[model samples]
Target: MDSRTMIASLPCLALVIVTLGYLGLCVVSPFGRCRACHATGRTRSRLGRIRRDCRHCAGTGLRLRVGRHVINHLHDEYEAAKR
Candidate 1:
């Protein structure tokens, strides 16, 4: 209503917007991992046998679907603009 009220609410507003955006992206996209280690981007075969990259994430911890990538790009742009 007033400037002070709006200023105090800015953080909450941003949080709500980000949360909704993330939820919408989650609904449209899905996550998958071929191995538990893939979720962490690397694999330790028996702790010391052999360490290797993840096939599921292709060495990245998080796997993004097609649309999810766009969402991520948008988020990055938003963050860049905010700064």
Candidate 2:
């Protein structure tokens, strides 16, 4: 393939790799609270309150990162929507 064609393909390949990596992390990571009761597993009451374990990590849980930029964007969207 020509250099132009090869260069054009790089971004697509990178995007595919990044998407796959994110999916793999979702499959493997355990860092969030229980969904049923929104509680971490350390406390007995919270654990008891959960009728069913989380599907993501089989009750191990996952902590989703909410970055400042994402929060700001969400806030902006919310404010705009309210208008």
Candidate 3:
């Protein structure tokens, strides 16, 4: 209720908001893609049809890159906390 109490609570409130926002970004970011054969628009042939191998990662792999903004934000927080 008083000015002193309100000021003391500001940091905790800000931390909560920041943590929630970071989690939201992580959940919404596309970190991975499906790996499967693309021939005939299916992974398998149900009736003895031809199936083409996946072209994105050559059917043996997939790559994921971290969301840069998220990583940078975390790094910044770490540096701030250390100081």
Go through the candidates in order and give each one's C-alpha lDDT.
0.75, 0.59, 0.60
> Residue by residue across 54-79, what tens digits does model 1's lDDT show?
77677877776655666778899999
Q: Ten consecutive residues with minimal summed lDDT in candidate 1? A: 29-38
Highest-lDDT candidate: 1
Q: Candidate 3, which ten residues in sequence have the lowest lDDT sum? A: 34-43
Q: Write the per-residue lDDT of candidate 3 for residues 5-71, one digit (tens) a residue.
A: 9999999999999977766665666344544532222344466575654555455444232454567
Off by over 4 Å in 3: 30-83
* Candidate 3 or 1, higher lDDT: 1
lDDT (Cα, tens digit) per residue for candidate 2, span 20-55: 776555545524455643553333345567356555
Clash totals for all models, in order? 0, 6, 0
Q: Could you tell me every candidate's TM-score relative to the true structure?
A: 0.46, 0.39, 0.37
Q: State the displacement of the C-alpha of residue 34, model 3, in Å, after optimal TM-score superposition.
A: 18
Ranking by lDDT: 1, 3, 2
CA-RMSD of model 2: 9.6
Q: Is candidate 2 or candidate 3 better by lDDT?
A: 3
Descending-TM-score candidate ranking: 1, 2, 3
**Which one wins on TM-score?**
1
